[model samples]
Target: MEPAANVLDLNQLRRSCSSCALYELCLPAGIGVDDLDRLDATVKDKRALDRGDMLYREGDPFEALYVVRSGALKTFVQNEAGDVQILGFHLPGEILGFDALATNLHVSQAEALERSSICELPYAKLQQVTSEVPALHRQLMRVISREVVEEHRHLVMMGRQQAQEQLASFLRSLADRYQRLHRDGSALNLPMSRYDIANYLGLVVETVSRLFSRMEEMGVLQVNRKSVRILRPELLAALCRSDAAPRRKDAG
Candidate 1:
């Protein structure tokens, strides 16, 4: 006898949660098919953005959460003087816009650092589905908790006085995130500009440039514009923990 006609269709599966690359990271483990279907229904089609495109500006009404489907985005806030402070850089497979959940108004602007695409989940629809899906509700809570933990970590990183340690930590964190995506941790293609990075790290652009050059000289990393290759992971890790400032050969 031939296989049943009710067999699964590859094309149909590709359009659902089963084929999403972020399925494991974005959804609950061992979720039932019915729950997955309901959750999937909340996700709108992927929306594309160009470099410098603003996804949502500060004070925009909170209506949806976005999952980075490709490329990168940066969230930032500008003071009255119009000086922009970058809050964070987002990568593919990561969810963003959680900051607005508390006040129902965005506190920062989200802009595409490069050409990007994202999947939007309307907050109302997401709530409706998640309420009916216990596992999904639990997963959403876990995601929110993880975001809080990461924000705290960023605050701690910013408090470190040494620029060397700050830069090192930033690189290490990026590498770790890449590793989690099952990609090459040693290599990174940064989507944000040096200015944005300096702003986010609370360092001057000149300082960030000098640090990158110094790290390259030390064989800790190789940098070419936005592309970086971490040559010595151990050395980078050491820098993250080191309290001493980088020494210059001309200091003698």
Candidate 2:
């Protein structure tokens, strides 16, 4: 196994990440050089989490907003049946814990699916900074808006799309997000396991595996365990846009 990383390494990474893909999307427009320095100073970087580690639990006191600097995170809520229904997967350059911003209490749990580094900006300091920095405020609002829009889209994906479409859309969405982080979007290193993907996609683990195999056979993707390569982006996009024919139960 690889040795675990340290907090110092995380801090160094953050400091050196001046050209990160999220810099433009995360920071407010027209932020002055001095303001950027202040914003950087307020962030507290944390070491990457091992697989299956809980970043925070539901009902935990909300203290800071977390930004995923690298790797993936899964947020989910438990149903009455004690099964976890995953809300979504957060990629690098995305912010987590927005639901807690207004209520000051977490409504769901965030867990690292792999070795994930994060930077925490304390709520108190963030509020103060936003008051002084108009750009920061604007950026925060944009982030919240993006979350709302994504949630709305997810609702449609779950309610209107068939199982195959849902699965295709999920893969395409993941690829897009990965690309945003300057990673190879077409080649996905899935941090979440088959069971987690199943829970998130509202399907069984076997069904998830079957879908992967079928997509591979159809030349839509190349799958090997947790890794996936999109062999035909256009076909996958077509399926995501509700154009692909539904696969038979046995076919997928």
lDDT of 1 at 247: 54
Tell me how far the alpha carbon of residue 171 in candidate 2 is from the true structure, in angstroms, after superposition: 0.8
lDDT (Cα atoms) of all candidates against the true structure = 0.87, 0.81
Specify the poorest-scoring 10-residue window by lDDT in model 2.
Answer: 2-11
Q: Taking the tens digit of each residue's C-alpha lDDT, what string does model 1 give over 1-252?
A: 634668866655545665678788788889988888787778887789999999999999999999887799999899889989888999887889998998999999999999998989999999999889888899989989977887887898888878888899999999998998889999999998888888998888888898899899999999999999999998999888855446554211
Candidate 1, residue 152: CA error in Å?
A: 1.3
| Residue 229 lDDT, candidate 1, scale 0-100 | 100
Give residue 121's lDDT in candidate 1 (0 to 100).
93
Model 2 C-alpha lDDT per residue in residues 1-252, reported as the tens digit of each score: 523654345544456334455786578667787787778777876557887899898889999998888788999998678878899899877899887876789989999988888878888898888888887888898888989988987888777546778789889888888777777999998888899887877778887788888788889998888889999999998877655656575633
- Model 2 gets an lDDT of 0.81
Candidate maximizing lDDT:
1
By summed lDDT, which 10 consecutive residues of candidate 1 come out lowest?
243-252
Q: Which stretches of candidate 1 lie above 4 Å from their native place?
A: 1-15, 244-252
